[model samples]
Target: MKRIYLSLSLLLLVIIGSRAANFKFAFLTDIHITAGDSIPYNDLARSVNQINDTPGIEFAIVSGDITNIGDRQSMEVVKSLLDRLNVEYHIIPGNHETKWSESGVTDFARVFGSERFKFEHDGILFMGVNSGPIIRMADGHVAPQDIDWIKTELDKAGKEKPVIFITHYPLQPGDVDNWYDVTDAIRPYNIRLVMGGHYHKYMQLEYDGIPGILCRSNLRAKEKTGGYSLCEVTPDSIFIYEHKIGNVPTRKGAYSMTGMNYPKSNAGYPRPDYSVNKEFPQVSEQWLVRSGYEIFSSPAYWDKKVYVGDDSGAISCYSATDGRKQWSFKSDMRIIGTPAADKNVVVFGSADMNIYGLNASDGRLLWKINTEAPVLGAVTIRNGIAYIGGSDHKFRAIDIKSGTVVWSYDGVEGYIETKPLVYDNLVIFGAWDKNLYALDKKTGKEVWKWHEGKPGRFYSAAAVWPVAANGKVFIADPERVLTAIDASTGKTVWRTKESMVRETVGLSEDKRRIYSKTMNDSVVCYSTTTDFPEKIWASNVGFGYEHAPSMPVEKEGVVFGSTKNGLMFGLDAHTGKVLWKHKVGNSLISTLVPLSKNKCLFTATGGEIGLLVIDYKINKHK
Candidate 1:
C-alpha cells in the first residue's frame, strides 16, 4: 500500500509538470540611461517594441543598471521607456545606480519600487535581489535582508518547484563580498537558473552548482547598437536566445542549461584558513574571556562594565576588573558593530535588521526596534535618542525610551554603515554614495553636504568615525586621503597627502596630532597644527590580506595598533617610534580599548583567542 502511494505521488507530479505550458520572457540589462543628450532612450525603445511584438514573450526582467547615474531624471527616463512594453517587468539595482547618484539606492527604489522584488508566473517562482555593497561602492554585497528574504521565498516554493534568481552583480568568489553567503542561503532549494548583469556581455557559467547567465548591455559607445536576450523556461530545462536589434532582427546565439562544474561536497570554494599554528606572545594582562565565535566589535566601557558583540550574535557584558562574564544577550544574526552604553542602558544593531536595547548591568532586553534592512553600525546615542543608518538606505533617530522612530532621513544615495557624529545641533555622517552629510538633529533635515571626488572618494562605508575638534571635522576615506572640513560652514579646510587609509584615525588630546594606519602596512603620525596636515613620522608595521582597519587607540603619549596577522605595536605618540611589539594570536581586527592612561585591552578574532588586557604603565616608559 505504501509503495503504491509513493508511486502515485511521483505520477501526479509528472502529470502536473507535463500539463504546464512552456513560458518565455525577455531578459534586458544594463540600459545605462544617462541625463539630457546622452540617453539610451532610442535603444531601449527599440527593444521594447521588439519585445512587445514578439509572440510567446510573457514578461521582462531588467537585471539592474537601468540608469547610468541613478539620478531621478535618468531613472524617470528609463521608467517611461520601459512602461511602453506590453509585458509586465521587474528591476533590480546595480553599482552604477548606487555609486553615481547623490541619493544612492533610494533614488532607484523610489523610481522602480524596490531594489528587490519577486513574482510568480505560470507556477514558476522568479526572484530578483540587488547585490550591491552600496555603502562601499567598490565591491558587491547582497544585503542580509535580501538574503533572508530569498530563503523565506524559497521555503514557500518547496523543494520540487524551480526558482530563478536575478541580480546585477556576478556571484563569484572575488566578484562579490558575500557570494558564498547567497549560494549557501538557497542551496537547499531547487534553484534552476541565476541571471546577472554588469559584465556588459553574454556569458554562461557554472557557479556553486547553479547555471549563471550574464547579459549584455543595451547600448554601445559609438554605434547605434543594442540587444536583448530571450529565455525559454521548461519544467526540465532552460534555453537562452540572444537577439540583436538593428535594421532587422539578428540572432546572436543560443545555449542549453549546463550542470554544475564544481564538487557538491565543497559547495563553491573551500573556506580560507585564518588561523595560525604559532604560539602567541605572553603579555601581562588582567583577565581574559573567550566567546563561542569571533569578535569584530570594539569594547564599550562604562562604570566598570565592558560591553561587546561577537560573530555568534551575542552581546555580552564583562567585568572590567577581572574579565568575568556578567550577562549576555543574543540576536538572531551576527553583531557586526560595537555597542553604545549610557545611563544604565546598552543599545546596538545586528545583521538581523533589528536594533536592541538592554539593561547595562543585567543584560535584560529592554526593547528592540525592527528596521527595513540590516543595521551594520553602532548606534549614536544623544539626549535619549539613538541614531543609526541601516542597509535600507535610511538614517533614523529612534526614541530610546519607547523604541519608536523619531525622524528618519533617506536622502543619501547609498547605505549608512557609520556612526552619526553629533556635533552642535547637526548630525554628521558619511555614506557609500561618496558624500558626507550634515542634518538637523531634531527634525532630520539636511543642513549641508560635502562630496569627496577625484583624488579621494569616501568609499569606506562609514567605518571611519569623524573626529570633531578645533572647529573642524577630520576623517580618512578608503581612498587613502584625510580631509578636514569646517564644522560651521561645511567647507573643505585641507586634505592630507594621498595614501592607503582604510580605518579610523587617532587624535591626541591637544588635537594637534593625528595618527593613521596605511594600506602599505605602516603606521604614520601627522601634525594637524600646520596649514595642511603633514606626515610627522612613519613606522613600518607589516600586515596581511585579512588586516582590518587596525584603528589605533591613544593614551598617555603612546599609540597602540594591531595587524590582522596577530602582531600588536605600541608606538611613541609623538616620535612614531615603535616602543614594543607582541603577537596576540590570530587576526587582530577589533579596536583597542583603553582602560586607563596606561593599561588597555586588545581583542583578537578569527579563532579561539578572544580578549587580552595589558598594562603598559606609562610611568616606567617616561
Candidate 2:
C-alpha cells in the first residue's frame, strides 16, 4: 500500500564536485525490481534519471541485488531498464540474485560483469564482489582467492592514488563476509574509500582507519522518501548526497519495553559511574497540566501532522500547529525508536520485540510481528518487510502485512542498540558485543561483519553517512570516541583518538562533511580525508552541562544540543564558537530534536521536557 506524499524537496540531487576534476562517479544499490513491479521499477527509473540530472559524473555504480528473483528473465529486465540510465553502470550481484543456482553468480558475472568488471576509473581502483558466491548456495564460498588479486592489482598501482573498493558484500559484518581474507589483504594499501551494497539502506562507518560508504538503493529505502546516495571522490576526501524522492507523512507511537528492570545478563548492567538519579516532577507550577506524555522520539511531520513516539508504548498522531492528539495507538511495548511513516501505514518497532504496522487514518494496529529480540531502535522497511535490530542480538525482517517473520540473523550475541538499515539488499546495525553486522535481506544469511578490535561496548546505533559524495561509517564506542570505518571491509579509515572524546552519538552529517560531538564538553566536525584526522573545528560549549552534552545536531551552519544541567546551546557549525545558549529547568540526556528550522525539543532528568523555539532564520540559512 502506498500513500500520496506532499513532496517537499526537489528530486534533483545536490552535489559539489572537486575543483581539480579529482571527483569520481556516484553509486546506488538494492534497487529491487521483480520484473513486473511497476512501482519499484518506476522509482528506480525516475531515480536514475534524476541522478543523470546532476553532472561531472564519471560513472555509475550499483552495489548489488538489481533483480528480486535473480531469474534470467528478471536480470534481463533490470539490465535493459538500467541501460536507459544514459550513464556507465557498474554492477554487483546480491544474495537475492544468487539464490537460484550454484553457478547463479557466474551467470550474473557473465551478464553484468561484462560491464561490472573492476577497474581504476579516474585514478581510483574499484572492485566488485557478488553478494553470494558466484558458484552455488551451500557451496557458496566468499571468494578468498580474490584477496590476493586485489593486492596484486594495487601493488601494480600507485600507493599515492586514493583507491576505492566497491562490492556487494562489505568486509564488515552487518555487511558482506566470507571475504575477510580478501579485506585483510587490502588493509595495508592506501585505499581511502570502500563502497558496497546488498544492505539497501544507507550507512557510513570508520573502523580501523578505513572509511566505507554503503549506499541506499533506488528501489526501497526506509526513509521519509525512497532515495539514492550521491558520492563525489577527490584524491583526499569523499562527499555524499542524500537525494530524497518525496515527502511521506509518519505516525507517532510508543517505543518502550512492556516489562521493567530491563533485560538481564551482565553484558550491559549499568556501572555505578554510569548511574544517575532521576526525579519525577512535582505537582507545583513546575509541572505542566498535560497528563499525556510528550512525544520524545523524532517526529516525522507529514500532511500537516506530527507523528512521534513516546514512553507509553503508543503511537500518537498530532496536529503540527498544536499539540492536540489526532490519534493514538497502544502497542505491547515501548517505542524508543523513530517510526518510518508514509500516508498509508506508519511503521515502527517496540520493546515487545515486535514491529507494528498501523493504519495512518486511525491508530488501529493492522499487524504486529515479533522479532528475535527486544527492539529499542527503530524499523527501516524496504519492499514489504521491516528490518529491525534489537536486544535479542538479532537483525530481523518481518512481513509488513501479515506480521510474520521472514528472515533474521542471530550470528552475534548482544543487544541491538541501533536500528537495522536496509539499503539495496543489505542489513546494517551495531551491537553491544562490539561488532557491526551486515547480512543478506532476502535469505537472512550472514554477509560480513565489521569488527573494530572489540571497542569494548556500544549503545549508540551506527549511522550510514551518504554514499558517493564523502562516504564513510561513523561509529561511537562507550569510552566516548567516534571513528569512521571503511564500509566495504570492516576496517578503520581513521580514528578520532580517545583524547578527542568523552562520549558519543556516532556521526551526523550533511553532503559536505561529518558533524561529530563528544561528551568531553565539546563538538567537533571532520571530513573524510587522505591526510587523515582533519578537524575542521572544535568548540568548548561546556557551560552549565549537568552531564556530558547529548549528541550534537548539525543544522544549517549551527550545531545544537543541550546538557544535563538543563542548559541548551547552539554553536557555529563551522567556527565552533558559541552561537546561543539558554536554560530550562530540566537536565537533558537526549540529543537535540529539531521540529523545524527554528524549533527543537529536549528532555531532562529533573522531569522536564520542553519544546524550545529559537530564532535561526539567519543562522539556519548559513
Candidate 3:
C-alpha cells in the first residue's frame, strides 16, 4: 500500500510541474524614448498594441534603456506607453537613464514605483535589479545593497525552483564590473537562464556554463518598423522568437533547461588580468582597503589623512602613511561627488539633498545645509568658503565655520557635477545645460557664461574639471573637442578636434602645458601658450578605446593618469613617455592624488582604495 501511494504522488508532481512551465511572455528593451522623437515613441506604442492584441502572451519584461536622456519628461512618456500594455510588466533602467540622470537617478523610482522588481508566476520566480555606474561615466556595477537583495531573493526561492535573472548588461567583465559577484550568487541556485538587453541584438551567450540571452531593441534601426522578442517556456526547454511589427514571429533559438548542473565552478572563465602588476615589478601596493561598496568620487587629502566617500553614504578618513581607518560618518543617501578639505574641515555632498561639513580629525558632523534636490557636484574650497552646486539650479558659497550660506547664484539652468575651478577671483564650473559659467568668487555675481554649439547635454562641457593657465581656461567635452577659452573675456581662444580628446584634461604644475587622454590609446599634450592646439608629444600607452572622465594629475615632473579598466599609469611630464603602467582592478579608476613622484593614492569604482608606490630599491637605483 505504501509503494502504491508513493507512485501516485510522483505522478501528481510531474503533472503540476509541466503545467507551471508552459507559458509565454514578451521581452522588449532599449526603447530610448526622447521627448520629441516621434519614431521611437511610435515604435514602442505599436509594440505595446501588438502585445495587447496577442492572445497567448501572459506578461512582458522591458529590460532597461527606457529613456534617451534620463530626464523627467522622457521617463513620464515611457511610463504612459508601458501602462497601456494589457499584461503586467516589469522594468529597469539602463546606462542611458542612470549616467545622465537629471534627478541623480531618483526620478526613475518615482516614475516606475521602484528601481528593481521580483515576481512569481506559475511556480517560476523572476527577478530583476539595476546595474548602474550612477551619475558618473564608468562600467556598470551592481550596488552592494542590491547584491544583498539578490542573494536574499534567490535563497528564498530554494535550490529546486527554477529562476530567471534579468539585468541591463551582460554578466561579463567588460560589461559589468562585479559580474562575478552576481554569477557566483546565482550559481548555487536552480537558475534556468539569464536575460539582458544592452547590445541591442539577439544573441546566445554562456557565462560559466549558464545559458544567457540578449534581446534586440524596439527602435527600428535601418528597418521600416521596430519590434521585440517572444519567449516560450516548456517543461524541459525554452524557445525565443523575434516578432517584427506587422510580421510573423521568427524562431531565434531553443535550449534545454532540464537535467542541467547547478553551482558551476569558476575554473575556466576569463577574469581581469592582474599579471601587469607582475610585469611592472617596481610598482607595488603599499596598503589597500576594500569597502565592498561602489565608489564614484576621487579621494581628497588633508593633513596626513585621506578622505573618500562611497555609494553607501559613508565618508571615511584613513591615514596617509598606512591605510588604516581613522573614523567614518554616515548620511542618509549615496555620495557621488568628491569631497573638498581645507582649514581642518571636510565638506561633501550627498543624494540625500544635504551638504555636510565634518571635522577633519574625528569625522564629527560640523553642520549640514539642506537643498531642494540632490547635490551631485564636487566641492571646491577657497579662502574659508565652500563652493558647490546642486540639482536645484543653484550654486552656493557657504562659510566653513558657521555653516551659513554666504551667497547663492540662482541662474544655473541645469545640474552641476564638476568641481568649481576657483581661479583668479572667479569660480568656474560646467553644467548639463550645454554651458560653462564663470562667477565672481567674492560677490557671487556672474562673470561670463560660454555655451557649446552642440544641441544635447550629452555633448555638454559638464563632466571635465576645468583647468586654467596662461590667461585661458581649458575644457574637453564629450564631442571629442578640446576648447581653450579666454579667462577674462569668456571668448573662445581655439577649439580643436585635431587630437580627439574627451572629458579628461589636466594642467602641469609649471602651468605651461595641458595634458589630456584621447579616445584611442594615446596621451597628448598641448602648449598652454600657443594660440591654437600645439602638440607637445603623443605617447601610445596601449589603453585601448578609453573614455573615462578621470583627470590626470602632475606632481614632481611625473604625470599620473588612470583608465576606465583599472589601469594606473605614469608618464614623463615633458616628453609624454610612458613610465609605468599598473593594473589595479577591473573597473574605472577615479581621479588620482599623487603624493610624490614615487607614490600615489588612488581609488576605483569597484570599491578598491590603495596606495601605489615605487619599490625603494628601484627608486634608489634611479
Candidate 4:
C-alpha cells in the first residue's frame, strides 16, 4: 500500500510540471515595413518562412511598429506577409504607426482588426495594448481605457495564472509618460513578464520588480540579414535566443518566471515633480476634469462653455466657469482636430470623413459635410466661413450658416493638419506635401506656394499654424528652422536655424514679436520687424528637451506656453522672465486659451481639462 501511494504521488508531480511549462514561440518587433521597401519586405518574408520551417513553435508575438510610415498600403502589405505565417500571431502598434499616420491613426485598426489584443494559451494569459504618443510628438502613453481594460483582464484571470504583458515601448518614465499608472494596475496581478521592442536590441529590464524583455528588431541594419527572437518556456524559467536568418539561434538569457513579488507602492520611483507649482503661490487649479479618452486638440471657448473633442469621437461641452458637464455629441470616428466656434455655431472635422457644424448651446448637430477622406485639419472660422482641409488632398471653405461649400481647392498634394491662418484676404495653411500654401479666402485660388527646399514630408511646414504680421508670414517646421515668408508672394524673406525651433510658433497680440519653443530648454522670441532673424529674448525655462507643438499664446503682457511633459508656464513677453510654472498632467498640453492675464483654459492629451487661475492678491503679498 505504501509503494502504490508513492507511485501515484510521483505521477501527479509530473502532470503538474507538464501543465506549467514546455512551450516555444517566435517574437518579432519593429518590422518597419514601408510599402516599396524591398529589404524590409524580404526580411519579413524570410522571418515568416523561418518560423514556419521551425518545428514545435506554437505561435508568434509581434510587438509593434509593423510599418514605417503607418500608411494604408504599407499596413496591407505587412498583413499579407504576416498572414503567411503558419502559426497564429498577435500584434500592436508603436509610435511609428500613429505619429505620421495619414488616416489619423485609424488604418492600423482597420487592417489588424484591433489596436489591442488578449488571448490565453496553456494556462497563461497574454495581453497586448497600444502605447502611443498618438497623433502628436510626445512621450508614449498607455491610454486610460487601455489601463482599465488591463485591470479588467487581470481581474478576470485572477492572481494564480501567470501572465505576460506585451507592448511596443519599455515601461519607463521617459519611454511611457504614464508608466507608473500601468505598473500600479498590474501590481496586484500575477504578472510574470513584460515584453516590448522599441530600442531595436535585446534588453533585460525591471519595472518595480516586474521583469521585462525587449526583443531585437527584424531589420538587418548593418548585418547581412534581419533577425528575430525565439522564446522557450520551461517550468522554472523562460529562455530567449536571437535567431538570424540562415544561421543558428544564439541563446541570449534566461529569466525566472516564478516567485515574483511586485511592489505595492511606487515609493522611490522618479515622477513628475509639482514643486514648481508650490513656488508660485498665486497659481492654482480652478477646476479639473478627466475626459476618459485621449484628447489631441485644444478647447474651444464660447459663451461660458468649453467645447472639446476627443479620440473617441465625442465632443463634450462643459461649463467654462466650474467644470460641469453640459452636453455631448458623438460622431462615428475620432475627432483629432480642434473645434472652432463663432456666434452660436461650433465647427470641427472628424476622421469619419465628415465635417460637422453643431449648435453650440445644445450639442446638436446642425449640418454635416461628407468628404472623400478623413478631415484631420483644424477648422478656422473667419467672417462666418469655415476653412478646413482633408486627407483627400482638398481644402474647402464652407458657409457655417448654410453648410455649403463656398469654394474648394483640389491642388494640395498631401493632407492638411494645421489651423489655417486667414490673413489679408488669404487663407494660409501647410500640408504634408512639403509646401506652405496661400489661397484666396473667397475664391480658393492659389496665391503662391512655398517650399523649404527639403525633401521629406517630415521637414514640411505642415504642423505649424502660419502666423502673419508686418506683411510677412512666420512659420516653423521639423527642419528646426524659423522662417519668415513674404505674405503676398510666398518668397522666403528670411530663414534661420539659429534657435533650433520645430513646429511651434505664435504671434504676440501687439504683433511686435513671434514666440517659438526651442528643441532644448528655451523659448526664443524673434523680432517681427527685422528682415533678419533677430532674437529678442531666449528664456531658458528648464523644461528640458522639449518639442511639443503647443503654440504659445501671448495676452496682456504675459506669454503662456505648455510642454510635452504637461508643464504650463507663464513668461513676461517683453523681457522673457519666467513668471510661474505649474505641472498640470503627465502628457502633452495643448495650446492654451487665455481667458485673461490671470485665467486660462487648458487641455492635455492625457484627457485632462481644467481652468488655471492666478490669485493676484496672493501674488501681490508674496
lDDT of 3 by residue, 229-267 (tens): 999988888789999999999998887767764446877
The weakest ten consecutive residues by lDDT in model 3 span 613-622
TM-score for candidate 2, residues paired by index = 0.47
Local error of candidate 1 at residue 335 (angstroms): 12
Best-fitting candidate, measured by TM-score?
Answer: 4
Q: What is the lDDT of candidate 1?
A: 0.72
lDDT per residue for candidate 2 within 481-589, as digits (tens), equals: 5666665554667766643453344243454555555545676667654426677777776642222424566666667765544456777665778756666542233
Task: Using lDDT, give the best candidate's number.
Answer: 4
> Could you arrange the candidates by lDDT from highest to lowest?
4, 3, 1, 2
Could you tell me which residue pairs clash in candidate 4? none
Q: Extract clashing residue pairs from model 1.
A: 103-412, 103-413, 104-413, 480-499
Residue 332's C-alpha lDDT in candidate 3?
Answer: 81
Instruction: For each candidate, give its TM-score against the true structure.
Output: 0.64, 0.47, 0.95, 0.98
Q: Of 3 and 4, which scores higher on lDDT? A: 4
- Candidate 2 scores a C-alpha RMSD against the true structure in Å of 27.2
Q: What C-alpha lDDT does candidate 4 achieve relative to the native structure? A: 0.91
lDDT of each: 0.72, 0.56, 0.89, 0.91
Q: Give the TM-score of candidate 4.
A: 0.98
